[model samples]
Target: MAIRRGRGVAAINYPTGMNLGGDPTQALVHSTPTGNFMVTLSSVDLGQGMKQIMAQICAETIGVPTDRVVVDTADTDTGPHCMGTFASRGTHRAGNAVIQAAKEARQVMLEVAAEELEVNASDLETDGQGNILVKGAPQKSISIFDVALSAHFKRGRSISGRGMFLIPRSYPEKETGAMKPSTCYAHACTVAEVEVDDETGEVTVLTVKNVFEIGRALNPKMVEQQLVGGSWMGISHALYETTEPYYPNRDHGGTDFNQYLMPGPGDLAETEIIVLERPSGDGPYGAKGPGEMCANPQIPAVANAVFDAVGVRIDTLPITPERILRALKAQAN
Candidate 1:
């Protein structure tokens, strides 16, 4: 008939991309007439800042300002082929493809600037400020806008490139079950503190602290927002969300969104996250995927916290009050 507090910790290692018969992604980079670069891909953004990150990657690879790059993921029909975005592969796979395309387009851009400046392409360099200049003599430079105009009207050249990335499938050895399944791994640990009401069997998550090793943070702000929002989703999956209440007999189940159960704003816990960078060689700019792993560790952490608080191990999800009370009653007997 009193409130009890407890803490628990959980750790997990998640894979970045699955090795599904050479998971492949393609990208196309081309310069517009206005000196802007367009990157076309089939990877969906899913509101995870995919477009922003891809644009940043393209701009960095092509030696231009981030604002000058645009990512176009309009649809699969127009864009290049991509193994659908899942298994946290969007950033790692599609980013590599964009880098390849941008590099090729950048080489052509340097060549175009070389032709205009009457210098060898090897002697040219990009200042990343919309200017292509000679390596030693910065004064002998050509603006990207002028270069684009020349390429289109004067040179009759297309500053465009296409690229695709695929990880050749590694078949398992016969002697031992050894094979490469994922491109890279991300690790995370979460500590959850919870308070349980012995009388009502209700659990209140007090705080959740997470530490993640996700290679590199392409966009720090976006990564932080994803981690924070994902923690709330983990909490919801642990103690609130359920599609079927009466399983084994599909007689009673949620029919619509209104019938579904989930936690409200008031039920959210204070969350703290710390990101660690351990760059992966194969990843794009040493950046791995933090997509699904962000919400993984918190589930087991909360379950362990509830067990620590009530001295009862509730294995099922949602951790409803009735289940807790029944466990308590059985323990008493």
Candidate 2:
């Protein structure tokens, strides 16, 4: 994972920008008396739940439950360096890699199966659910478990599996500063409704309705949590939070959290959410990043809500009472 923010080390405020990430191929194998098989990566998942995805894929590759599958992240010391997880790229890249690894491991299993049953690997099938069946004889076939045991005890061979994904992207050839090509992109939209006091410029968010096009809903619960968390953070970032905007005239500072007010418990209002499901192409399992979409609409939505309440619109962020009063006076004239 490579994080190349545009802001310099000395820069105080870094504007929002795109984040990129990648992955490497993961490979593992084990040899038994009967056969050798391997396991591969679907991708690296941390608390975000990529591990679960891998477990499922791994179990399928080895013909076991997700719980039964063992996983190991590609290590730089003993294993190849997998791209560190970031930019929400784990499932897509790593999932593909895991597929590759599983295929390699399956070859060994099929060979062993052919030897035991006296049939070609093509004549045998290992369903993702752990059942292994011969093409013409279901009753004559055995389980992947039986096959694994045979390879371990009888053949005196090993079973191994390997998989990886090298998510492709273009890098700048010259030293000239240019945006790198991104492999995946996520997009969304949200709407909000509210009211404001023209005199006090106090804005009460009536109902914040969020409509977003998630690439694909991987986990509805997790997606909702992302929206909730992001919306809350957006509220603070756009409505109440204040930071000093140093200028040439006032090179020094002001607008500390204590001095610069924000929307607290009393200032808050009702929040409603609506999701617009749209499948994004580059996402994993049709899952786009929902972490920042709600945030994008927060400031604009709150500003519009304030206008509906007080019949005055404040273009700037925060939409403070002072600004509202000033806009109301100007409009009244």
Candidate 3:
């Protein structure tokens, strides 16, 4: 038998954050004596660049340069309260909290700048270049560094703010049972192309093209990396990764990495990603979570591709050659 090529597609709509009794997150924004801003949170980064996204949000909200902002993911003992980072809620929930806190701190900074410049705080605005200037008067300005020094020594005031974001829980309607489970939804579609050998029962993935609507891409490069890496994980789950060889019988299972099966770099497929931005109303700066959704569609897509190639449906994960040959043999009987 010869190898047969096939293509299949899958799509999904993923929720941004859980809407459980106001899943809440808190943030604290405070300016240092050296004019740098600090954002303290209890949410862990988990290597997903949460710290960088929070820093960008805080810096933007406070009208400061991103480099001047630092994010500290301190533990619950030192940082503010946070409902642990899950359900892809880090960016949407914590980001909103950081925005609120940064706004309050920025207000105090403007007030301090107003006092130093002898102008109304309402008329003052930050240039995002470490300077606060009067509207329409570029020459009349005060540096954020001087303002911070004055606030600490001369004014004897601490520039700090606290904020928390909570989405009120929605109750199901008594009659229709309608309820809002999430604040927003992110969408994605993936098309996987593969070749399957009818005789050998082997499958080779050729390419995976994905399109995602993630509300907004705050950091395009990071988004690309996450999506590409996630697609690889999806491919692994679809064709290679497995620990339970004899299911329903727990006797035979992979106990170590050497015994486990997974795809290496040579097994990776050619991946292409296209990002679409549809800003959410309540999302922080129109940004939503793109956490695990990137790895979802590829599973079903690959499964469907195998069916199209061999005319046999394989429902189990890590569709091994033995399973494919069994399906083919059963079909031939």
Give the winner by lDDT: 1
- Candidate 3: segments with Cα more than 4 A from true spot: none
- Tens-digit lDDT track of model 2 for 190-300: 455554544456555545555666566666776677677666656665566545433345543344756666566665546665666666565444555555555667666
The stretch of ten residues in a row with the least summed lDDT in candidate 2 is 3-12
Evaluation by TM-score, superior candidate among 1 and 2: 1
Q: Write the per-residue lDDT of candidate 1 for residues 212-284, one digit (tens) a residue.
A: 9999999999999989888888888888777776566676567776767666777779899999999888999
| Residue 142 CA displacement from its true place in model 1, Å | 0.5
| Candidates sorted by TM-score, best first | 1, 3, 2
Cα TM-score per model? 0.95, 0.65, 0.95
Candidate lDDT (C-alpha), each: 0.90, 0.57, 0.90
Candidate 3, residues 221-318, lDDT tens digits: the string is 99889898888888888887777765877665778877676667778788999999999899999988898888889999999999989888999988
Give the per-residue Cα lDDT of candidate 2 at 327. 88
* Model 3, residue 314: C-alpha shift (Å): 2.1
